[model samples]
Target: MAVSTLMFAICTAIYIAIVLFLGYMGFKRTKGTEDYMLAGRKVHPALIALSYGATFISTSAIIGFGGVAANLGMGIIWLVGLNIFFGIFIAFIIYGKKTRQIGQKLKAVTFPDLMGKIYNSAFMQYACGLIIVVGMPLYTSAVMIGGARFIETTFSMDYNLALLIFAAITAIYVIFGGLLAVIYTDSFQAIIMLLGMSILLIFTYVSLGGVTNAHEALSNMASLVPASLASTGMTGWTTMPSMFSPIWLTLVTTIILGVGIGVLAQPQLIVRFMTAKDDKALNRAVPIGGFFILMLPGVAYTIGALTNVYFYEKMGKLAVAAAGGNTDSVIPLYINMSMPDWFVVLFMLTLLAAAMSTLSALFHSMGTAAVNDIWGRWRNKKPSLAETKAFVLIMIIVSVLLAYIMPGSIIARATAMFMGLCAAAFLPAFTHAIFSKKPSTRAAASSLVVGAVAWFLWTAFVHIKESEPLGISMLLFGQNAILPMPWQVVDPLVIALPLSIITLAAVWMVERVTTTKEEDAAEKAI
Candidate 1:
């Protein structure tokens, strides 16, 4: 190996050694399923905050959505605001305390477990678990792609090898040490991410001669937008697309709104609340989480937009054009070409940290969901730690296969797709479970079915981006989509989430009326 490659390898080895040491510490502390799944429910506020933030902002946020910003321009900034406000403020203050209290009260160890206990029905657990097992791999795959892309860029390694290695390394701790290991390592990764992102923003601004100059340079290139994008409604890097245009709807409904509101129902994110020791910990986490959120996505999006300016000035090409048409490559390409060698190594570690932190949490959640809700329910027993480990290994392989099969330039879209489905399927039922005095199982069930089905139907038929590739609509309807313009561009979450909410409300009201009448009529001599 070259001297530089050898030095970089040494640094990475040291970092991984530290992470493994922390994982071992977690292993030593873990005494039972509770400790493995919920970190013994005594995590410090800072650890909780960092773990949550790190898990929330993965490689998908940095490399994937950052690349989206490069393609779609600064308009992607809306997502950062929603991430902080809805994902942090509303989530911690409104949902965290309730989830922590109720989870403790009912001895719920997983998200599905909490739902099942809330409704006094094992079916709730089974349904939620099935969703996680089936749907989470798409997201997990996308995150792996983000990490592998950077590793491929950094080490000049084969994409397939990078993906397998990334998957295997991230799986080790999650398989053996479970959630506690995930939490400690994720917290450490979070600090790395903060430093990396902070330096990235600084370097980007300095390269472009400070913030104002960068924004102006990007703004001045409005007329340079590609014909395809401009015709679709994109105005420029610094401005929103034309209202109700195809690009505008896609940006507003699909990218921005999809992920913005979708964060509420994410299984991995919600489980963080269950690990909190008390309401005070949750409260203390808010500002810390908010700051972390502001720094990561905020910097990613800002730097992404500015990369266009850098490319235009340096090579007389747009960011996407400079990257040869693949948006996913834009951020990675820019980093390699623009940053110093030492910074490249540092940022490579950041991407690794981002990917591993999120992947560890995802593997832990999926494994526990499989054990506590699906397989364990089938076996009619509390699953052994060995069983959870086995399932974690299985899930890692599944996600790795998915990452291999998924097409290029897919990271952002897949992330949105997963988040949107979660919003449509889980948001209504999850909200009802934690807040309602008596959450209606029938209502929650109906909502889950309708929401998931609606979203799938829309994606497979009406949403052009997905439907065109899936070819389901073509086979059934003789066209890529069953609809024209606007509707084709509208995100499924926009339509399905409302339907889910309405289904739950309607069912709950009907149940309330019938139950009241039945009570008045007496027990019918049973």
Candidate 2:
């Protein structure tokens, strides 16, 4: 069932050519710093919606999370609902419109710039930017690993070579054309992804003899559930895992809520709102964004779960077993074994699109943080497009190097860990900034510090999934995690995000009370 590598290479070349052409168009349109950094705040509504959707649904979401769906069952569909609800509807209607208006009024160019300007504090800008510069690479490197690993395996190329090629191609556009180029190429890539996933869904359901039969067949395979998974509460491919079981906690908290709620504060995603011209654009984009988000992960997760029936029928083995128990390999293995030769090429393009779209946005966000927020704010200077581009190249190199250092398992945790961190560090303060008329700088600072610190401490000392590998807890306390059973299994986001919000609310109230008392004393003296 292997397809022609030469054919894949040719199709990939054409895809890359179109992407580069779009990037070139973006560069042509980019005539000022605003154009380069914020797409001139005049991007088309459809383009904004498509680019935002593309940036959110990366290769990790499609392949890694899809593989998760294959192994963990259709229960992961909960995340799809949250994605549309929070990632699109709420993000655009509640956050995106506000962000657009405020960002335009303040002339904010990046997420950190928005924060710094809103607070009127240079320290706020630097700290936000610093967090992005330091933590974004963990997510960025995970993305690089996903895309490059696919290229290496699919075309039989060297991993290092694949990594370099992916990095260089994405960097060239982002560094030269900036956010304008990133969005332009993103819209183009989004189309490819939509087409590719649409085809994947049709092919999967049709090949399984139809939707009803596929579900029935999969449900029948409940008895085929591996003993290992059953012990952890897996019921079947179609049902949710046992409530409060280890699997349930991991699925619901770590996978579902960690990413679902975490999407609100993603620096790269928030930056897309700043690219909008007005509330009208954001309002118009809601349904478009919602539909785009639905098609991408919705199709991936559904097709991923149904892949079990296909494998069971063809190989008499389940999806995970068919791929030799490596969940990461499940989707690719299914495609190679079951899909048509032409579709293989298209799917490969789909993955590349997912990777490039997200990567370009990450590069832009990181670079802007470095040049515009951190360095420029510190020096009290306005950064030029050239300087930001240089920093973009630097961040790209940093992320590529980190990809070599980090393990492939980061893919599974990429969305959860990175988004969790962003939510913990920025979400509360970001919410306050946009919604509160008289936001407290002290409260914002304290929340950022507390949230980030709490998230890291929990990851390093309490979350067994992360702590066990980190070995920090074992090194310090002779244990993998400081807690036992359910506590160890619970995700950091669940612990840290609430703590972050509490810290913000507590401090803001304290400051408000203090100021009110001071004003009363002054009035008595007068």
- The TM-score values for the models, in the order shown, are 0.98, 0.98
- State residue 129's C-alpha deviation in candidate 2, in Å: 0.8
**Candidate 1 global CA lDDT score:** 0.92
Q: Candidate 2's residue-wise lDDT over 1-526, tens digit each?
A: 6678799878888888998998998899989777888998888999999999999999878888888999999999999999999999999999999998999999999999999999998878998999999999888877777777666656677988877988999998998898999999999999999999999998988988898988899888899989998998889989999999888999999989988999999999999998887889989999988999899999989988998998988899889889877676778888888889899889889988999999999999999899999888878888887888889999999999988877654676866899999999999999999999999999998999999999999999999989999999999999999999888888999999999999999999999999999999999999
lDDT of 1 by residue, 208-241 (tens): 9998898998999999988999999999989999
Give the number of the best model, judged by lDDT.
Answer: 1
Displacement of the residue 486 alpha carbon in candidate 2, Å: 0.6
Model 1, runs deviating above 4 Å: 1-3, 523-526
Error of 2 at 389 (Å): 0.9
